[model samples]
Target: MIPEDHFGSDAVATNRMHSAGVALEELLVTAQKQDCLTVGIYESAKLLIADPDSVVLCVLAVDNEEDVALQIHFTLLQAFCCDNGITILRVFGVRRLQRLLRGEGANRNLEEHGDFHCMLVTNPQADHCRLQEVDTYCQESRRMDQWIPELSLQER
Candidate 1:
């Protein structure tokens, strides 16, 4: 799995999160306590948006100064932030990311930067290379025709 540092976020900050491989239900419970924003893709996010039990996106900015719940929520964010399936690039000041995605720039930049892992998968299973069969749930969901550019992680 690609680490969050590959995306260029504070790797140390993300690394500090303890993996709680407990259970989905337990995670959800922790999420609720932490007030995480649910980040969904395509239409799947609609269900999360409508549901009060959870938020709809992964990158949420809940204030953690008040208590540990929010901190726990952020911990979860940091956990998935480095997800190997996802390419969470660090966008400092440019909206050029849209262009990067629209073009095959992501793949090319990886080669140019010697950081190809930033855009393309390294040593993926033979099935992942096919693109069409790759599921959005896999994290690197760029293959599906349904993937909208807006849902893509863009930093302002």
Candidate 2:
């Protein structure tokens, strides 16, 4: 009982999601290479509090939606980002992102870096195209009434 327009809209949404994911992946990789990436919730929060202006983007990832503590942390982080005028994106698949950032078979130094729930891309010396792409996607999502658009990180 679905109308023809329903399928068309679904396809468009899928395309937009895919584009956002790719853009995010590219941004993360570039930030990592540039050494402008900050990992973990505590570390990112400290960085935000210490130097908010240096942060260009904040990405919150969640694999377990039932974690109340994590949810609260995200809420606080979102409010901070909003107040500071920093673009924030919600993504799923924290494990995938951890592997992507830390690399395969990397040592787990949770004590030093904390978990990979929140990541921040700090200011890079040079202009980045991926950053612009992500910003554009965020703006489009906001226009569509999505305050914090959710994206998925591809499994490699």
Candidate 3:
């Protein structure tokens, strides 16, 4: 696995490995607690435009091995989120996201179309602490003008 600092010191506020692990764990926990998490480009785009206030974070995956067009699409998504003041994080690929969403291990099989290029984490529930933590992380990241990591299709 790539070191957490490979992203940047701002990626995770804490230096502890467990804390970094907790960030991902907390994210999944928050996702499970709500119905606001949306997977897929179309659904995520709609959430970005129609309910910007509810969007907590936008996680983009480099899963499509097609061509640069897929990369362009993700760039556009990032621009949209940036313009809308939404926090965006680029992960390795769809498998990683699917694993998190499904609460499965690396050996688990991924369902077709279960792979999403963009996932919008929303806060429709409004009372969860984990979601609040996500929001806070995004807000702080924005304030520092730093992104967690920018994983490109070629990077995987």
* Pairwise TM-score winner, candidates 1 and 2: 2
Which regions of candidate 2 are displaced past 4 Å? 104-114
Model 2 clash tally? 0
- lDDT score, candidate 3: 0.62
* Poorly placed runs, candidate 3 (over 4 Å): 1-18, 63-66, 104-112, 128-156
For model 3, give the 10-residue run with minimal summed lDDT: 104-113
For residues 1-156, write the lDDT of model 1, one tens digit per residue: 988667765554233211111121223223323333122222222432344232222322221145475445444433444442332222121223223333432333223332111121222222222222122222432343323111222232
lDDT (0-100) at residue 21 of candidate 2? 86
TM-score for each of the candidates: 0.20, 0.89, 0.63
Residue 96 of model 2 has an lDDT of 76
Give each prediction's root-mean-square deviation over alpha carbons.
Answer: 17.4, 2.5, 6.7
Give residue 138's lDDT in candidate 1 (0 to 100).
26
Query: Which tens-of-lDDT digit does each residue in 28-85 have in candidate 2?
Result: 8777767688888888999999999999899999988999999999999999999999
What TM-score should be assigned to candidate 3? 0.63
| C-alpha lDDT (0 to 100) for residue 12 of candidate 2 | 95
